[model samples]
Target: MMRWRSRSVSFFALVILVGGCTAAHSGEPSSEQPAAADVVKVSTPDTSPRPNDPGLDAKLAPVVSSAVALAEIPAAVVFVVTPSGSWAEAYGTRAFAGTDPVTVDDRFRVGSVTKTMVATVVLQLVEQGKLSLSDKVSKFYPEFPDGEEITIEQLLDMRSGLFSYTEDVSFNETLDDNPGYVWKPAELLAIATSHSPYFEPGNGFRYSNTNTVLVASIAQQVTGETLGDLLQERIFEPLGLHETSFPADGDHTMPVPSPRGYLYGTNVSALQTVQLPDAQLQAARTGALFPHDVTELDPSWIWAAGGVISTAADLATYARALVDGHLLTHEIDRLRIESLGQLDETNPATIRYGLGWMSFGPMIGHDGAIPGFQTFMGREPASGTTIVVFCTMRDSPTGVRPANEIAKNVFRALHEN
Candidate 1:
């Protein structure tokens, strides 16, 4: 879901917000490592009231409201659970011009957040001895350039130098021309391989969706099952994530209780630049121009890389389990935590990317963005604090990731409290 060529602006904003965290650590996953006490037992959301700090709502409500208004997002849901207490709130409306308010339970297309689930399944396969991180890409698809040199770990960590199909000009054109086209995984890979890789495999880092698509394909090849089926068996079922689902190909519908996703510009326009013309920006800000509702656009184009649908509650639960060793064995979880490396070595405060997840400040998780929706999910492993944000709009006219912006402000508010 990351557009490598245009990711700098958004990534810079993230770095500024989370740069105060610890320097990146380096290591590989080893079975000999001892279990870390930071692991916590996973629990479902409590319906009963829990102790909460009175000052939290006062500090956070304005952050969400101001961000939503400034970013021109149609709606958003922010949920935070800390050692002190929990706060969940929804803002704006379900549609650009609708009067219905969005609720915290409404579902959203979580974009690249789906990568974490696919990565979890891949790690589970490694745990089951069906896969190895060192396995070369050529082991499955022998045609890829330097496939022999690319490891599964590289793909999981965004170190794969594969070209991202999403960045291809034709791919974006197709998305704009045929929003309903059902994209197959092979088609996506073909588009990526048609172009030369950004660099030799394992030599550098680039956020390529092609890497994740390949990982999902490999998982399917090894298990002789679809990615959706594997996720259902390994993650959704075990974690009791009833609100989450990977949509079947050709199914462009969102489940009920979901808001319409809005976008200000076309895919090509966004690819060229996230910023809108001055006149358009002014009109949009004044509500004279409304964003197009793209809620039903076929998501198959992103496939296993960015095609999961879930609500804030499910994301909160999944984020906790992802970092707390609930889904994988403690040994693998420790390795995952220790695998984090600075995305930009030059910036010490740069957010670190690990095995399919990221560390920003005290939280470890991922953020996602597609055409009409944006999401952020993270949990502080030590304190068991979790934050989930979902914005109905993909990005602001100024190219800001609305969900991440709000999440960053919320994180600041949490630390202050």
Candidate 2:
């Protein structure tokens, strides 16, 4: 449910990608990985989605096609399911600057969607009597200013009113210059706290990466373990997601045989200005400037806020668990639902941001985006349906909004049919 505030003004008819090392990390799945028998077979998409009518594949294709066409997205993958059946499709390529076609198993950055996982882990701790929703930030990070005023609930609701450090013009400038710069939790908080609060804590709503960062830090402190470890112990292992991992460093290269991500950049010369494609955009940003491994993003930068990488199948599997109460007991589920109530009024009602996931009509989940990728997934618990979509290359010539539009359109189409 986190929306991007930035927009592109100038459009490049064609773009180029700068190639080099990828900055992302990968780790071995623990012994707790789920059994193969539990993993459901993800069916290939055969029919297009229908809007008002059911039993029509052509109708569904147009909706998805128009959305992709309008967005001019370089690459996209979509999967949807309902009581009747499931369908998944891959469109475009992994990198338009190159000839690599996108496959069903390609991995993509989940951006803020990682927040849902972090929130779920934290809530699980609460259910285990290891953490408390009412706990104050002061309990974990006594150094943070006004920690007492910021409760766990406020942080989850984004009602903490803490100004976002991402909005700092200087931060953006530095980020542009040193795309690989590593960030620390304290540094990120200082940037955020330096600004005034958007409103009183627990009052109005404003989205800030700071809230999730704090949540991540707090979760680690309370559990005496890395967020990644906690996730494996509870969710990933239980679900048996082979492709999901949280690289603390910002390494961009996927493990051996992983799909390559291409970033589009502007190149100008006397002869002509053209877009270039670089497979190493992620590595350059994380390894070179950040001085951190690509596999593990500075845990502090995204903290619990946005550092998560997952496959489309894994994303759908996780969403199904979250919505169906496989992860949260009924008592704790109520708290999570309550946390989503504080979202900004501008977002759609279908999008009621709960503790971690966003509710869109019957669909409940979150979406993620970074510089080169966009991801989203949701589940309709009542109908036992799950939808997961992923796209490579962020902010193309057309724009990034199409990804968002696709999520909504897909949800509506599924419901109507």
List CA RMSD, all candidates. Answer: 10.3, 11.5
What is the Cα-based lDDT of residue 205 in candidate 2?
Answer: 79
Alpha carbon lDDT of residue 258, candidate 2? 41
lDDT string for model 2 (292-385, tens) is 1122223335556776777777787778777767777789987776655553322333567667678766667877755556677777666677
Reference-based TM-score, model 2? 0.75
lDDT (Cα, 0-100) at 62 in candidate 1: 80
Flag regions of model 1 displaced more than 4 Å.
Answer: 1-53, 342-349
TM-score winner: 1
Candidates in order have lDDT scores of 0.79, 0.61
Query: What tens digits encode model 1's per-residue C-alpha lDDT throughout 1-417?
Result: 223343233343333223311111011222232123211234655522233357767777887678778777788998887767778888888888799999888999999999999999899888878789999976876545567788999999999889899999889999888899987776777678667778877788899999998888888766656677778778887678888999987889999899999888888888878877999988988888888788888998998889999988888889877887788888888889888843332221247788988887667889999998999998877668788999998888778998888887777766663
The worst-scoring run of ten residues by lDDT in candidate 2 lies at 12-21
- Give the residue spans of candidate 2 off by over 4 A: 1-59, 256-300, 338-349, 396-400
